[model samples]
Target: MSQANPPGRPLLASALGGLGLLAGMVLIAEGGRRLPPDPPSIAPAQGADHLKAASHAPLHDARPGRSARKVAADLIAPPPLDPSGIERTEPRPPLGELGLAPRPKTPMPRDWRETLLFRPVATSSAVFEAMGRTVAISGTVDIDPDRTCTFDNTDWSCGQRARAAFNAWLRGRALKCFLPPDADRFAIAAPCALGKQDVGAWLVSNGWAMAAPTGIYGKAEMAARNARMGIFGPPQ
Candidate 1:
């Protein structure tokens, strides 16, 4: 047979049961409040307002919508306050000092007939140098070895001798030259004297060259040929 329970013990047991039930109910209600709200009700993204919000949404973090990575970069290296703040060590020189100076203006000739002078770069026995131009001896042909003298049979170089003589005559001399109608040619007559003698008449009378086909020095050439002078004479 079982003995009966004490009256005080039953009351104590009932009160303890009631307290445990109340504590459980309080915990359940607190947990329900703290739990994250059910994820926001997602509206269909097809709507215009939703599309606009998506487009405008920040892609990152503490900087709204900016990525965490970009935020870190900004903290590590801040953007420049002024884009043009950097200084140049070597400043550019002024335009004139840099050889960009303007060129002086040149005066133009009033007419086509007005002549301008420039320096010649090259000169030789047959070519006269002036104002950077050449004036060929108009009536003279170049001397060559074939030109002969009746006075001697020796193989002499008449052309070489003639060129030497011409050069010698030309030294310390100046001549006036005119441009011919042909753009390619110049016409010039030597003055009566070159150096101590008449050099123009000398070259022909001495028989170094022939009169031109134009017959400018035909008389001088004839006189040399008859006298058997220069290359027309015996080889020296």
Candidate 2:
């Protein structure tokens, strides 16, 4: 008989072969898992042509051959203003051209009457200063310096006494009278005052001068007449 193979040796060789076969199968599976995916299929000719035309077409028709700077400027620029609906105003015509009287220049304001101070010298019972250039006290009747009055059946120079009395009362005091700016240096019947005392009222109330018909000193004159004061009474 031929020499028989060892039993353990055969079994060990069989195990080694099986292990090598299993290792080769595992390596093949791993290689398949790591492979790249397949590429996509190509498009049709018509679709490819359409895509090429779109890519070459201009973005805007109004701006031909536009540069990058100009495109950026257009993006940031303000919109143009529309002035079609705005209303335009016309200049006004002059008054003379419209057949109307030229607008009268505003008349310059006239000077206001001003109060003047005067140191008067009595000429008569109701007058101050010279005859023609006198400040005749307003609202009073002038008594002539030569006038006479009869009291207790005795004649007396009443007018002279009245003038003397007026002079004494005045004592060279200043009088204030409202006069026009254009007043002339002539006799003017103007109301006057001496330290808040009305000259005309004082004369009429004291009986040194008679009140005018329309004078405001009627009541004062009546009071003086009733009291028989000043010239109304006997000479004193």
Best by lDDT: 2
Colliding pairs, model 1: 58-65, 59-65, 60-65, 60-66, 60-67, 61-66, 118-131, 119-132, 120-132, 152-234
Estimate candidate 1's alpha-carbon lDDT, on a 0 to 1 scale: 0.58
Put down candidate 2 lDDT per residue, 1-236, tens digits, no spaces: 89988879989999999999998898798985665779766578677887899899977656768554466665699877679977889967766646756545433235625465555789899888632346788779888889998878988888998998888888877777755554456667777788889999999899999888876677788988899877788986
* Candidate that would win on TM-score: 2
By TM-score, how accurate is candidate 1?
Answer: 0.37
Error of 1 at 45 (Å): 99
RMSD of 1: 22.4
Query: Candidate 2 clashing pairs?
Result: none
- The segments of candidate 1 whose C-alpha lies over 4 angstroms from its true place after superposition are 1-125, 128-131, 145-151, 180-200
